[model samples]
Structure formats: C-alpha cells, structure tokens
Target: MSAPTAQRSVLPPRPSYAAVLRVPHARRAFTAALTARLSYGTVSLALLLSVTRATGSYAVSGTVLSLFGAASVLLMPVRASLIDRHGPRRALPPMATLYGALLCLLAALTWRPGAPAALLATAAALAGAFTPPMGPTMRALWSELVHDRALLQRAYSLDGVAEELLYVSGPALIGVLAGLAPPACGLLLSALLIVAGACAFVTSPVMPGPRPAQAPHKRSVRPSGIPGLLAPVAVAGGVGLALSGLDLLVMAFTAQHAYDTALVPWILGALSAGSAVGGLLNGALPWRMPARTRLCCFAAALGLVIATTALAPDLWTLTAAMTLAGAFIAPALTTAYLLADELAPTDARTRAGAWVNAAVNAGSSTGALLTGLLIGAVPLGICFLLSGGVAVGTALVAGPRRRRYADRS
Candidate 1:
C-alpha cells in the first residue's frame, strides 16, 4: 500500500478579533495599553490650549509645543531601545513614574497666571523627552503575546482604530473641559491615566519580561533585520509627508473658497473616517495575498486615489477622493507593524517601532516645509498631487522587497 499522504493544516489569513481578546489577560493588557496611549492623542491638544490660555500668544504656545514634540520624537527610540534590551516591565514603570511626575509639574506651572512661557516650554520639552515609550512597547508586547499571525494583524488593526478614536475625542474633550473646569485639568488627567495605565499594563498577568537566555532570530545580511524591514520605515516617512500635505491642502482649500474654518473638520473627518473603516474591515477580513503584497496593493490604490485630488473641483468631490485615499492608510500601517514584528531582531523590535515613529515625525517636518513653499506658488490640488506621487513611491519602495515578505515561514 502507498504511504499515507501527509496533510498540513492551513490557518486562515485573518482571525477573529475576539480570539485576540480571549487570550489570557489579553483584555487587561490591551485595555491598560490603550488607556496609557490615550495621552498620545490628548496631551498635545490639552497642552496647546492650556499654554495658549496662560500665555495669550499663539506664537508662545506653538513654540512650546514644537519644542516638546521635537524632543519627544527624538528621544522615544532611545527609550524603546532600552525596553528591548531589558523588557517592558523593567524599563517602563520607573520612566513612566518620572515622566508622569514631570507632566504633573508642567500642568501645575501652566495652571498659574504669569508663568514664564520660555521656562515652561523648556520644562515641557524635558518632560516630553522622557515620556515613557508606552505605545511601541505595548505593540511589542502584543506581538510577543499574540503568537498567531492572524490575531496579531487584528490587534494592530484595533490599535489603529483606538488611535483614531483617541485623537478625535482627545481634542473634543479638551474643548468640553474648558467649559467645565480649568483647561489644564485635562492635561493633568491625561498624565495621571498614563501613569496608572502603564503600571497596570506591566503588572498584567500575560505581559512578559526580558529573557536573556532565549536566543533571537537569525541575523540579517546587514546590520538590519530582513532586507524589507527598513523599507517600512521609509514608507512611514512617505505616508507622513502625504498626511501633513493633506492637512495643509485642506487649510488652503478652506481659505481659497471662503469656507468657514469650522467646516474643515468635516473634510478631515471624511479622511479619518475612511481610515477607521478600512482598519476595522481589514482586521475582520483576510487578505487574499501575503500582507506585504497586499500592502503594496493598498499603497498603489492610495496613490492613484490621491492623484484624483487634482481632478476634484469641489469640496465634496475632494472629500471623496481624500476618503478613498485614506482607506489605504491604516491597512498600510497595519502591514508595516506586522512586517516590522516579523523581521526585526528580537532584541530590537521595540526600537524598530520607535524608528518608524521617528521617521514619520521627521517626514511631517519635511512636508510642512514643502507645503510652505508650494501652497501659494501653485494650486492646492497640485500639492496633493505631489503627495500622491509620494504614496506611489512607497509602493515602489515595497516592490523590491516583496519576495522577502511573501515568506510564510
């Protein structure tokens, strides 16, 4: 008789989001992580409003925020490197405590009238520079805990959604709190929640600590991980360029048409709403191809759709093109998150995430510079066209690495 043929079991390309939650202590960890990160979305707006209220100059507030933001972006990867070298538990708590304390101090200083804006700005920079690297650490933790590829994808998707919601609601909450309490109170609340949440997350039952004895993945041909690992960082930079340009394009569009500034949010909301829907759908549904190939496909679609922005003659039409373009954003990001997890050196995964984050920040700065030069010189539509071209460039960036990531090994 012929030997029995062997059959390998096939897993779905995507799994239920509930499966991610059902894992031991997954809910607790995810919840704590989410709350800790809410500060990411809330703190900036709260600080901006509070500082502006106290100082009475948008220039001072902008300077303070810019300094804090620049410092935070530059320092985050350093903290993430520490987290990876040690572990979240050892690296997160102490820093979280100190950062949170600094945040409280900044808030207190901002609460009083006649505070020196420059000194407060310097203090804010120091506080934010040391802000605990919670977001990337939680992502690394999720990657470790959710061993199943399918579940990990969903988890990242959920993270993207949570990020969008927090960003939208954070600004609105600051507005509401201004009516009910001191505006700076919202900043203090964000600080406290981050402290509590970071502590709880580390203490969660499923969260892992450093395992020095455990070996890491096979080294890459160069100093980086897989050949494609670094590509996502570049792609992230491109995406950021597109995002900042889009924001500026909206501002110009509003100004050109005499549309109320309040109406700009609706257009912006259309973009974010598209991304949120895409993230939810992507998490729930499996892709037909590998994440890498599918991501390139999404990038292509985003580029092409954004190109249509140049053709849009009205606000509603431009909003439609923007929405279509935004649909690809979260999916590309989710793919990048997963790819970075798969390909990063086990000891540097957190750093990889932080590097990607930094690239995005740097790209935003670059985009603002470009937009400043382009906004008055050409049609706003042409500026979007340039950003779309950047999106297409991301696809080109990923294309060379496609074979490396098709790997289901």
Candidate 2:
C-alpha cells in the first residue's frame, strides 16, 4: 500500500467526550457556564408565573415576557462586544451582578401582589439587557482551550448536549419548586445561580484576559459588517425558526386528533433526546468533509426530514418523525458555531458567536409568533411545510456559490 493509503487505514482512535473534559480547567469553566445558563432556562417560566400572579392579568404577563426576551435577544451583540473589548473577567461579573440584582428586585416586587405593571416591565427589561452572554462566551473559550480542530468539534458537541439538558431539566426543577413555594422563589434561585456561576467562570485560570483596544484610525470596517457570517447565521436562524414552530404544530396535531395535551412533553422530549444522540455521534466520528460543506449538508438534511413530519398519520408517528428531524439540529448548530469561530477576527470572537446566538433567538421568537397566527388560519400540514421550507430555502441560499466576484483592477 502507498503511504497515504496506509496512513488512512490506521487512523487514530476517535476522541471521546472524556478527552474534552481532560483539557486543563475546561471542566470548571464549562461547569460554571452551564450553571449560569440554567438560569436562562428557568427564568422564563418563573418570571411568567410570578408576573401573572402579581398582575392577575395574562396580557400583562405576556407583555413583560416579550419585553424581557426582546431586550435579551436583540442586545446580545452589544453585550458581547463589551466582553470582547474589556475581557470577560472585567465585563461578565458586572453584568451578572446587575442581572442578579434586577432579578432579586423583580422577585421582591412580584412576591407581593399588586406591584405596578409598568415598574415590573421596566425591571424585567433591564434584567434582560444585563443578561451575560454566557453561551457565546463559553464557545469562544472552547476555541481557546482546544487547539486541534477535531477536539474543538467534540468540545462544542459536549457543550451543546449539556446545554440542552440544562434547558430540559431547568423548567422541571422550576415546576417542582412552583408546586412547593411561590414562583418568585424560583426566580430568586435563578438570580443566585447566575451570580455564583459568573464569578466562578471568570475566576477560572484558563479564561483569557481582555483584547487590546483598537486605535480609532486603525480599526477596520466592512460595509455590511457580518458578510462572512452570513451562511452560518442564516442556517442557524432557519433551524431555530423550524424547531420553534415544531412545538406549536405538534400541539395542533395532537389537539385535532383529540389526544391528551399531557402527551406533548413526551413527544418534545423525544426531539431533545434525538438531538442529544445526534450531537454525540457527530462529534465522535472523524469525517473527511469540510466544516462548511458539512454545515450545508446538515442543514439541508434537517429541513428535508422536518418536511416529512407533515405526513405523519398519528401522534406516535409524528413523535418518531420529529425525533428524526431533531437528529440534525445539534450537528447543524455545532457546525455553524465552528464556522463562525473560523470566520471571526480573534478580537471579536465573542461578538461573532453572539450574532449566531442572536439569530437563533430572534428566529425562535418570530417563529413562535408567526406559527401562533397561522395555526387557526391555515391547515396544520401546510404550516409544517412552510416551517420546514424556511430551513430548506435558507440552506440553499447559504450554500457555497460557484461564481466569484472579480477583484477591482
């Protein structure tokens, strides 16, 4: 056999998730990030219930949540830019502190019934504005920690799976706490978790210091700032839009079939479980395909699989179909983050990740709103098709083009 053939035949053993944790200080930093991120999972439910109880109005509660989510998602890039400029050690702690204090204040105000609605809304929005960009920051840190591309892929996968689990379990924990005590109690716990986790994360020895300030005249500017990030951001947004709509579509399907609404969680759980499995498998394998190509393929596959969910005949079949669709979710997201990391300038890594993060959140919010409107007006199957089409179309648009622009002579 030739040297290349022989080398290909004797590839090294695939690196395990254990290899990721073995990176020095990775465990502590990752653990801290997860702890802080759990607050995100719990805060929505806790805040919703607390606001509802305090205001005694669903409309008010909904408005408050919208304000909070908008502030958090829309301002993510701004907060991340500060971290990139000032360093996480300096930027993150203050954000966490202020966020925690706002949560505390909101909890206190909601603890007593009849707090002013305007006051509550203002406080929640402020809290969201200060919410630390933990997920993006952690991904940026992962790039710093793992030198090998394959190893970094595994780290992102592990991080994705853990974050998914945190979200799944966070609301369950809040549900239990809500059963025992007031919803504000859960909100208070959220505050504590973020404050403690942010402190721990910043103090980790592996975390890097701040980037040097750029001179005003030396700073580079692109006309459409995020041109390099277009593909990843588009794909990420498409995935988010599809996934968010899935929940509502499933609900409508179950309701039409006269199936118990209680079964909704189990079906959704299958999607999450499938995503977790796919993520683990994606990271474990060593593939020859380039990351960019892999991203396009993963996204296209997800869109196609999700489109098939429109034809499911029953809840069980729908659950299975959704699980299959979900298999591509994490791998697509992992590849997007990888691409973002590669395309971003070193000094603005956090901001780059944040843009991807923001795309997902913005798409999700828009999806939920649009899907809700479409549910009563259009046929459910058609809605599913539209949802999946969003992903497929984005994948097509974001895929690499053959044409290259001529350089200015």
Candidate 3:
C-alpha cells in the first residue's frame, strides 16, 4: 500500500493542428461547420446576382445584401448571448435549422416573378437573424480543449487559415454553381450545406457545455468591464475598414478597366492565398511573442505592406503587394482574438467573440460605403495609402497601451 503512490493526471501532450481533429467528433463537426460557413460568401452573392437578373439593378441587390448584413451584425451579440446563457446543445440546433430553412425559402422565392423587394429583404433578415453562432462556438471549444497558451494560439491560427481559404473557395463554389445553372441553384446548394452542417454540429458530443464560474470568480469577472477589451475591438474595426476599402478599390479598378475586367478576383485571391500561407506558418511555429506584442508587430508590418501597395502601377505589382500585405492580416487578427479570449471572463467568451465580429462588420460596412463614395474621385492608390495609414496609426497608439494592459492583468 505504501508503495502505491498517486500519479498526477497529465493531459496527453497538447494536440498539434493536425491532431486537433483527433478529438471526439472534431473532424466531423469541423468539416460540417465548414460547409455551413461556405454558405456565408455564397448566399448573399447568389441572391445579389439572381435579383440583378430579375430587376436588372445592382442597387436593389446591393440594398438587400446590405440589409442582411446589418441584420446579421445586430443579431450576433444577441445570438451569442443566448448561446452563452442556454448552452450550445439547447440553442444552436434550433437556430441552425431555422436559418437553413429560411435560406431554402429565400432560394425558392427568388424563382418567382413579382416578388416584392420588401418581402425579399424580410426573408434575408430572418435568415441573418437566425444564422448559427458557429465561429464563437468553435473558438470557445478550442479554448476549452486546449489550455496551454502556445497550443491555443496554434488553434486560432489554424482557424484563421480556414477562414482565408473560405474567401477563395466560397465565392468560387458559388460562381461555378451559378454559372452552371441558375444563380438560385447556388443558393439552394448553400442552404443544403448549411442544413447538413447544422445537423452535424448539433449532434457532436465534443461541444463544451455551459460553464458557470465559481462564486468568487463570478463576482470578479466582468469581461465587458475589463479595461483593455475596447481597444482590441476598435482595432478589429479598423482592420475591417481597411480591408473593405481595399475591396472597393479593386472593384472600381476592375469595373472601369477593359484589359482585365476580371482582375479583382485575382487580386483578392492573392491576398487570401497569402493569408492562408501566413496562418499555417504562424501556427506551425513553436516560438511566438506574447499576443499583445504580436498584435502590434503584425499590425505595423501590415501597414508597411499596404502602404507599399500604393506604389503598384501594374497588375503584377499590385498582386505582389496584396500578397505580402495579406500575410500580416491573419496574424494580427489571430493575436486580437487570442487577446480577447484572454481578457474576457470565462462566462463572457461567446459574447466577447461576437463583439469582435460586430466590430469587423461595422468597420467593413462603413469603409465600403466611404471607399465607394471616394473611389472615382480619388487616385486609386490613395485608398491603399489611407488604409495603410490607418493600420499604422492603430498600431502606434496601441503598442504602449498594450504593454500597460498586460501589466494590469
């Protein structure tokens, strides 16, 4: 009996990005959820394209998409709050089911003529309102499954990589499907993918349940009340603003220019391809600076790369600059997410993530509108320069405060 000593429980070594799939239902759930996410860039674009065919007006289609985005942004925090309160098991399935059904309905309605624009907008709003809170759920799962900071960052990086890849694949898939048949066909497929994904995620046992903090910790934890949270949220918005501005600039360039009418995609693809590579490499690395430091460094590097894009006079130069600039985007965002996770109270995880998302949406919407207004009037290069300046300015202001926030923690 004396010889029998207790052996401490050591978690099987931290799972690498590849190994993350080995967790129970992780492969199935992640793959399914990915399909659901694929619907993201598809449905809205598909609707836009389909409606344009019907009414021959980009403005109407644009209005619908804008309204959907606004509706989604408004609902993210609310949906996340519900998930946090009720736990995913009880909450996610109903929302996903409703969302998928609404999308299917939207696709069906698009086939008919004389469907009022208001009715279409209402359907989109409903779909957006019910869209499943998958991103935050995935992040919360990673946080729960991987306790070590190093491994967790890897997880976030990997997640970031998937998101970048989606930028390519989502639109490509939608384009292909639409080209093959009706644009509504692409939306139909998107709905199916989302429904299938919802089924997979809802049934997954790996989902972390509601974790009510201990009494003492609960009293002390108020993630929104924390000192440094707003800074990262603001930076997230800035990132969105810059990216959207760049998007509009590319759109304007492609629309007006005859040589490469389709160049916008290639440009955006380069940006995403670079981001994918950066995210993977960043995750694979064993050594990393602190999240706050990484955030500032990545932001500054992004600033430099984006600023250089202003010098691009041709497609090659623009592509090269975009590729280089895009690399820093994912890494900076990864750091911001990690910081949010760190600073937020355990109970507030989903809502905190939602806030980050909302910031991005807000920034993207505002930036796109502003850039659209300015694109024809200004030298196109000025857009890149201004976006880069924003990034650089954000970094400079955040750097010292980042250190202070860490110290306070």
Q: Which ten residues in a row have the lowest lDDT in candidate 1?
A: 214-223
Q: Which stretches of candidate 3 lie over 4 Å from their true place?
A: 1-15, 213-223, 251-259, 402-409
Give TM per candidate. Answer: 0.89, 0.94, 0.88
Go through the candidates in order and give the C-alpha RMSD of each one to the true structure: 4.9, 3.0, 5.2
**Per-residue alpha-carbon lDDT of candidate 2 for residues 249-273, written as tens digits (9 for 90 to 100):** 9889999999999999899999999
Model 3 lDDT per residue over 230-333, tens place? 76776777778778788777766565544475778778888888888888777777654776677778888887788777776677777888898888888878
lDDT of 2 at 186: 88
Model 1 spans with C-alpha error above 4 angstroms: 1-14, 211-227, 401-409
Residue pairs in steric clash, candidate 3?
A: none
Native-to-model Cα distance after best TM-score fit, residue 125 in candidate 1, in Å: 1.3
What does the lDDT read for residue 256 in candidate 3? Answer: 51
TM-score attained by model 1:
0.89
State candidate 2's TM-score.
0.94
lDDT, ranked from best to worst: 2, 1, 3
- Candidate 1 lDDT score at position 392: 81
lDDT of 3: 0.75
Residue 260 alpha-carbon offset, candidate 3, angstroms: 2.4
Whole-model Cα lDDT of every candidate shown, in order: 0.79, 0.90, 0.75
